[model samples]
Target: MAQMRFITALLWLLAAAPLAAQEDARPDLSIREPERGARARTYVLASLIYKDAEDGIDRFPLAVPELIQYVEDNTELDVRLRGEDRTLRQLDGITLLYMSGNNAQLRIGAEDRRRLGRFLQDGGLLYAEDVRPRGLGRFRFGDAGRSGTPFDRQFKELVKDPDILGAGGSRWRKVPRDHALYSSFFALPDGPPPGAHQPGTITDLEMLEYRGRVAVLFSDLNLTYFWGDPQAHSRAPSLRFGVNLLVFAIARQQAGPALR
Candidate 1:
């Protein structure tokens, strides 16, 4: 039965691929800043560097611009398109960190992991996605023992105990349907947008909350690819979801308390 369901979902995605392709054009890279003298917020695309994963940073080229445009067009926040790729150690004033890669064996040092932990504990949000090709060492929830790629293993290590948010036994779990993140800026009634990565199964948008705010938002489905074409019909919900994430993170940061 599970196999049948997977087959059906694959077929559906295949059927929709052509339509998505038709709309897959380069997005408008020009960023429109608010007339106000200085930008209010800046989103960072933290480029993950791993000794084993050299090409990891090359996956999502359009993600930064699309996210920048989406936030500016839909909200009153004065956001800037500052997509400077930086290491985890340089996360001083950054509020949001978007990390995606294809390597499963990716590794980060203990010091960098501690730095990331501190950043999240300081009211920062980390949005991570694994973009490994479907059949090739991709990350599957139940198959973690077998299919867990390097990124998967490293990510799990990074969020383990004594890491600030992950301390006190905190862990990632399914984001409830009614969570504010689903409806912060745009209503995501059906949860995360469907992508070629995971078809039949609902791609779980896992969250790790500390105190009363979410510190990490993770998806195994390479959502960065979903931000490919801003004008694509199927890309709207995904883009909106991205905006909602940014809005939620910013609101929580301004609410004062870092950890309850």
Candidate 2:
């Protein structure tokens, strides 16, 4: 029965994906200043929720679910979905931050994922969203422009905060082509398969190596297109790249030092 349900879902998605999605469908995010009130919290429990929502509504919400369904059908893992939001930074002994997800292995600790972006326009750095906002491989799927996205402003604001950056310097650099991530599950000789992947026009995935481990991974393209694209299940590079990324997360965790 489970197998049948899974297969049915896949067929439904593939049949429903509109060709318009193939266009530049990634929404341009209108990330405003973090509102003055107590604030609404958004945390992704991995497969359940991939995009972050400030007003409780993500621009393109189909990517994560489509991606999750794609993973289950193609891979052996059966994911348990859970997506929610919670308070942040309130701590007893100097606040502690952690991220949680079912599909993606937990990084800092357990249970807490804000939107794909914590950085917002005119707000404190890294402190805006999830815990330990260090650099990482990141992307703003909403807008493709190199600059002027809400995430760009928010991230820049976070970078300025000394408390946020902590002692470790920004080891920000392009993920080396030979890094294990490229070939974690499937081999991509070039690099991250772009969402709006166009010939001669692409961006490298970036990462923040804090201490001896990779703290963050970022992408600028809306690789989400692959999630719902009709060619997803086939041999789409974006989908394959997404799979490679999730697989690499486990590999990265295994290599990181013991968690506190």
Candidate 3:
């Protein structure tokens, strides 16, 4: 009765959410940096473990090192990649958690999920992605389709489940052209802004606000891949887009009670 279990879990989440909401209700303010270690300019938590589907192509790509360098090079912030020893419970000092898609899955169990879910509900942002998947119109997962293409099944589960992060609303829209990602700080003069998203090209990417504090950002396109390529350094438009996202997440995370 997997279906029954799923339904039961959903109901339990719905029933328990309001009480958790009230108990953790603090005015959306800056979370104090934890005292244990030297403070990073910006603490970024990345899920490094990845499980590729049987498919040949990757559904998600883990690009932690690439992303870390981008943040250091492009912004004033010093970002630290969280190790596995720590749990979400140790997130107090961190400003943002970057979920590297490369087939990454949340390691939390059934009970701990409620806490992580509540963390996002209580205003903690999680930036995640679903990298390119395999098994499409033509290409199979592998030799004679023996190995299937990479597909991030868990990622799909999290995004579609409203009880997990409350981003299932249709209002969770893609970042439009007007978003600061296309603004001057990143792109040089005369360069065109990132092109209009190709029709139906914006698959699975989303942005949504919760509890007036946390903002969840997801994209299928790999910013780390774009940032990691040495050739892309001269690609101002793409670089700008990458930098914009990094800054936007930081600024959005730090904004006070009014931000959504």
**Top-lDDT candidate index:** 1
Structural similarity to truth (TM-score) of each candidate: 0.69, 0.50, 0.54
Q: Per-residue alpha-carbon lDDT of model 3 for 120-234, expressed as tens digits?
A: 6655666654443333454321222111113234554554455566444234665555444334135333322332123333323456655533356755544444443454434
lDDT of 2 by residue, 158-242 (tens): 3334443433324457778977667655668888765443334337766554333455555545455445445444436766776
Ranked by lDDT, the better of candidates 1 and 2 is 1
TM-score of candidate 1 to 2 decimals: 0.69
Off by over 4 Å in 2: 1-59, 77-148, 167-169, 197-202, 228-235, 255-260
Ordered from best to worst TM-score, the candidate numbers read 1, 3, 2
Taking the tens digit of each residue's C-alpha lDDT, what string does model 1 give over 178-229?
Answer: 7767765566888877654545554667777665567787777566665744
Q: What Cα-based lDDT does every candidate model obtain?
A: 0.59, 0.40, 0.44
Please list the residue runs of candidate 3 whose C-alpha ends up more than 4 Å from where it truly belongs after superposition: 1-42, 45-62, 74-90, 102-108, 133-156, 159-163, 166-171, 181-200, 203-205, 212-214, 228-237, 256-260
lDDT of 1: 0.59
- Give the range where candidate 1 is weakest over 10 consecutive residues by summed lDDT: 13-22
Q: Which candidate do you rate higher for lDDT, 1 or 3?
A: 1
